[model samples]
Target: MATPLTAPTTDPGCRVLGLRERKKQRTRDALVDAAHRLFLTQGYGRTTVDEIAASVDVSQRTFFRYFANKEEVALAVMSDAEDYFIDCLRRRPADENPLQAMRAAITEAWLELGQDDQSGPAGVTAALELFELLETTPTLLAAHLRRTTEQEGVVAGVLAEREGLDAAVDLRPRLLAAVFGAVVRLSHLSWTSDTAAHAAGPDGMIALIERHFDQLGPALAGSWR
Candidate 1:
């Protein structure tokens, strides 16, 4: 069964951030919004840093202060989502196994994002478009894959901490992390290739991931005959 979406709590620190920090955050958000809009409307490759900066009415130097390059801004939303999933994983119940924790964390994170009013309907639509954009664009796809690889270690470390294992010495955490990541990547590939799945959007991708995770045990341990 799917987990029900719950309201996200506001961080008290957000309220206490000084005026300068708040202003910086607003500028950063504006830049991200502008970048996504440009990336979706114009092809990611065609969108320039100057154009993104211009859209936010910020100078190119100010844009560089927030993001290193166009690719960084292009991926900023996804990076935030990944961070949220890590946060969710950290909060998962200790009784759950690593794979179960990972699966639940991702589902919880996506559901929360889907229900967020700040994200809105237009934001959801943009996310769907961005998924397609990432899959089709070679440069972005390569960068995305590289980022995914880098994140596996972080996930493994989290799992290790949960299980009280040494991630560097004990390979189980890393193994589980690799398997989980592979399952997610496979689901994404399948989603992108199938027209029907692609049409179903983020929900379809999540369902597909759940189905693939369900098959892991059977595929690894059960006989084909």
Candidate 2:
């Protein structure tokens, strides 16, 4: 967990000299930005923690202050999306069914992402490339999978609370969360492989996900060969 940022303070004969919280945030962001650039260009396996810290003119100790390892830095980019989805899920209306709520939450999350300036111009192309990096790199893939598992548990607990079920005792909440996660992973694999899909970019990925959600009914209820 991140240490809570301290509020600026002042007292008689005392002064808050600078924006300590903002400076820490900037350093953390710079480390992530530099790491992503190196990981994208030189590849994750080739990049070293020292190089990441040096790129930001910070010490190895400073880098460790922000992230435990290179894998943590690599996943920080994706963590924003994860956080957005969970926040949206928590805010969805009580009347909506589980699947409907998931869909609506993701839609809102993506809409907010579209308006946000943070993604910037290394662009969606860089983001997709990073996804490809995760898919192909063993160490990164393992880390990604671990994060995915942790997020699934979070989603399941959220679902249980919203539906008034005991998450520990009832299986429905976990089952739905598992299915939703599987669909997301499957959609990613399908979207990444279709060479013809490159031109569509982020929108194409979203469309693929929507199509997968559309099939969830038949996928769960109908027979398969």
Residue lDDT tens for model 2, 11-104: 1123453578557766776777788889887888899999999998889999999899888988876775676688889989999998889988
List the lowest-lDDT window of 10 residues for candidate 2: 1-10
lDDT of 1 by residue, 1-225 (tens): 111122222222224656676577667767877888788777888889999999878899999999999998887777777777888999999999888899999888777766652442135435656767888899888998888888889999999999999998999998888888899888877887778767776677778889899999999899878
Residue 34 alpha-carbon offset, candidate 2, angstroms: 0.8
Against the unseen true structure, what C-alpha lDDT does each candidate score? 0.77, 0.75
Work out the TM-score per prediction.
0.86, 0.85
